[model samples]
Target: MGETDKHRRIMTALIEALIAFFKNIAGVYVSGNLMLYYEEGNPSACVSPDVFVIRGVGKNERRVYKLWEEVNAPDVVIEITSRSTRLEDLGNKRALYAELGVAEYFIYDPNQEYLKPPLQGYRLAQNDYAPIAPDAQGKFHSAILNLDLQIVNDNLRLFNPHTQKFLLTPLEAQEAVEQAETENARLRAELKKLREEK
Candidate 1:
């Protein structure tokens, strides 16, 4: 494959992994770089979010997200910094998401070069992004998904507050479910013994 194709493939894999991680913990829809159509054939009107989450939406993979069809924009939009697109991601993209009524906006620097500290989060208030403070662990809480975002080992990870654990990918989640069932069975057997004694 060519250089551009290789890069796109790598990024696509990363995004898919991240989306699977988030979906396992929460009933939300995750999409990456799907075209948002604001105008026909208008280069300036096209906007694509690197990664976005929409709670309580379809769980199937989509080719392209049409705002008119979806009836609502994403609740949380994440942008991964790239050399060519850094300015657009931080400036115009931020404004576009805000104008579209996205509840949260997140940007991360995978290279950790340009935007020092690598991650920035904002919650929409009064039609604009309001900076959100990261927690002691340098994690930002997402108001839309009620999850936390943290950079762990150079990859952005999502933490589910409800479970008090970092969200897992589909495979991890399946393992977790199996583990939980085993524990429950063990507890049931113990309780049965106690009842027999009584």
Candidate 2:
């Protein structure tokens, strides 16, 4: 089954934001909706996550992600679940990620049509995945990325704990830049008026 437009948009937006966030970091690869082949020869053993981040791997383009080639599975896997993929994302994929030793697994339901809470996080514990407890405001923490996952106004957002701000999409980032420029212009004008008065 194909994903709805909203699902695709959310996946793209989140992936872009994560990539931009980690752009300066070395040995970090961020990908969206790419096929991850666990085994070298077996095509059947593969899954394409909505978004994945692998630390300690070269950030290069590849047709598929071969676990053996990289010598490591993705450190973090995020699935943007729709109604059709909800079960697989939460069940089979969850087990596969745990088995692969993925440190973190996250699921987000943009439409809230599948998951009860719409956002969930799991951490690998003792070779098994344990559910990550949400904070008081229902924000789940990601140990791998060191960020908070929150659902705000029916949208999934990543929050930087240290910066205490939400990571913005490319469009949102552009808007922020524009707003800052406008504010700076206003301040400059005010300063000019004050200097003239002096």
Candidate 3:
């Protein structure tokens, strides 16, 4: 399934946002659209999840994730589903992740045209993936990452419950800082004007 530019951009943005959010956390690795080599010596047997998080793994760069080398599957795996890859993402990939012991599996439809709810999640229970219910706000909670996944205006968003804020992408964060600075400057000017009047 070939992805369009919009799909690519959304995937990259979400991955970058997660990376930025967890950059300072030790032993946490976040990546997107990278191959996970499950079976040794079988280069053909690999799955590249759209966004994945492996806890307890060193935050290092890798061309491929050899599960045998890492000694464990990713704690969380997210698939950015498209019209072309919808079936595979829902069936084959889900089965593979469950068989490989991925603790959590999530599917996010950026286009919001395929998946019924646009976001779905499952938690590994015993030997199968159990569906994780969404909250009243249509946010799926990831116990592994301890974050809430939601769709705001068709964009996939990750919310930090601890901070009660959405995890912003790099660009978004910069824009936020700039906005704060601009507001601060405006307030300072007003304060100076008030002092002059006094």
Candidate 4:
């Protein structure tokens, strides 16, 4: 309820990029702001993450993810953080993810005022979580997702170093298509004029 506009925007962007990037991959499920019930029948042992990815599972929608039934906890979990949730995100949530054996845990403070670096990550190792060190460019590499997590212009961004491009959100993808169409139309007109002149 206390989520800001930036938090919501970042969450949506992550969700869009994850879907677009992983849609063709088999057994990859991405979701946001969903209840992950760790205990099979105990509703109280649940955590609602801002964004999560579970591998080796069907990509179908679920009202709530039951870990026992799925046989896998989220491989990656990301939180769009705020000052109010700082304690929870860094403390309880961190412990819970480690306990659940989430391979990667990331938190991004889009506002830039809450966290010192505004982006941080942890990787589960030997049942304990280890800090994920940022690279020279300040991007934290996600081995599970095979992507780099960073902040771009005050927003959480996923960059694919392999493609040498940042994964686009849904709106950004739409804008790219529109821009390409416009450029193509202009080039077509110019080509017709050149042919007529010749």
Candidate 5:
């Protein structure tokens, strides 16, 4: 349709891709543009994070997440920088998430104009979020999720330290499990043949 609609669609696709990728990993939940209601003064003031994660939340697709229903704010909230929303994301949105007691805050600039390299992270301390140190590779670790945020090949990717592997999507995780089971069965059969020969 219009240019704005096209941009929104593109962003939505990107968000969905990231969420799907992160869901393949165990103990992580990624949501995008999920409405987070806070105050009652103005419904329009509701916040929808571009991307967020809550570890150990289990694997499931959610149509929408209500803050009051979830009983906890997201552990990590990521904001995708855009021309119209860059200022708000860096300012009001940051303050709002901090006041809500979110554990971590991340900002990314897909345009790569204002925020070059396009990734920043902050960890909540006491009543506010303090800047977090990025690793030598310019990747930031999430204390809450225990994952690293890295820009790989111009796209933000989630790195799982426990598995020392990049998290996969739901389908990928399923396939991986199946593949492992098949390999294990093959090895077991080979071992049985060897024992018989002995």
Candidate 6:
């Protein structure tokens, strides 16, 4: 089923932010809305997650995720769920991710369709999933990525705990650069005026 525009935007932003954050690190793969085939022959054992990250595997382009070939399942999975996919995201898909050894699974409801708090995280422990508790500010930490996940203004965002900074999307990063350029130009003009007055 096709997702809402907001859902698509959120997924794209997250994928871009994650790629920007982890691009320098080797063996970290970030992908979005790709078919994950767990079984070799049987096509039924497949699922397409909104965004996922797998570590320790060489960063390479793949048409579809093949668990057998990769030798590892996604360490983290984020599902941008809505009213239509809420049930699957919370139930069957959740269980499937756990069974596949996904270290952390997060589900976010951008539209506030039905999920309470709109963000939830779970950690795989002992082959079972345990609820990932939130911090004082209600941010869930992803141990796999060493980053914190939170909802800001009803949008799912990633935060770097170590840096105490939120990961900026590509658009946000570009805007930041432009703002810096504008500030530098203003400062240069002020300095020129001061030199002339001197």
Q: What's the lDDT for all of these models?
A: 0.76, 0.89, 0.89, 0.92, 0.74, 0.93
Model 1: per-residue lDDT, tens digit, 1-198? 122453354346446655766646655787776777765456467677777777766778787777767776788888877677779888988898899889999888777877867889999999999999999999999877777888887767778778898766455667889999999999999999999999
Whichever of 1 and 3 has more TM-score, that candidate is: 3
Q: Global CA lDDT of candidate 4, please? A: 0.92
Q: Is candidate 3 or candidate 4 better by lDDT?
A: 4
Prediction 2 TM-score vs. true? 0.89
Candidate 3 vs candidate 4: which has greater TM-score? 4
lDDT per residue as tens, model 4, 127-148: 8889899999999999999999
Q: After superposition, how far is residue 121 of candidate 6 from its true place, in Å?
A: 0.6
Model 4 residue runs over 4 Å out of place are 187-198
Q: Quickly count the clashes in candidate 5.
A: 0
lDDT of model 3 at residue 116? Answer: 86
lDDT of 2 at 131: 88
Per-candidate RMSD, Å: 5.6, 2.3, 2.6, 1.9, 5.5, 2.0
Q: What C-alpha lDDT does candidate 3 achieve relative to the native structure? A: 0.89
What is residue 67's positional error in candidate 5, in angstroms? 2.8
Clashing pairs in 6: none
Report the poorest 10 consecutive residues by lDDT, candidate 4. Answer: 1-10
- What are the runs in model 2 whose C-alpha is more than 4 Å off? 181-198
lDDT for position 116 in model 2: 82
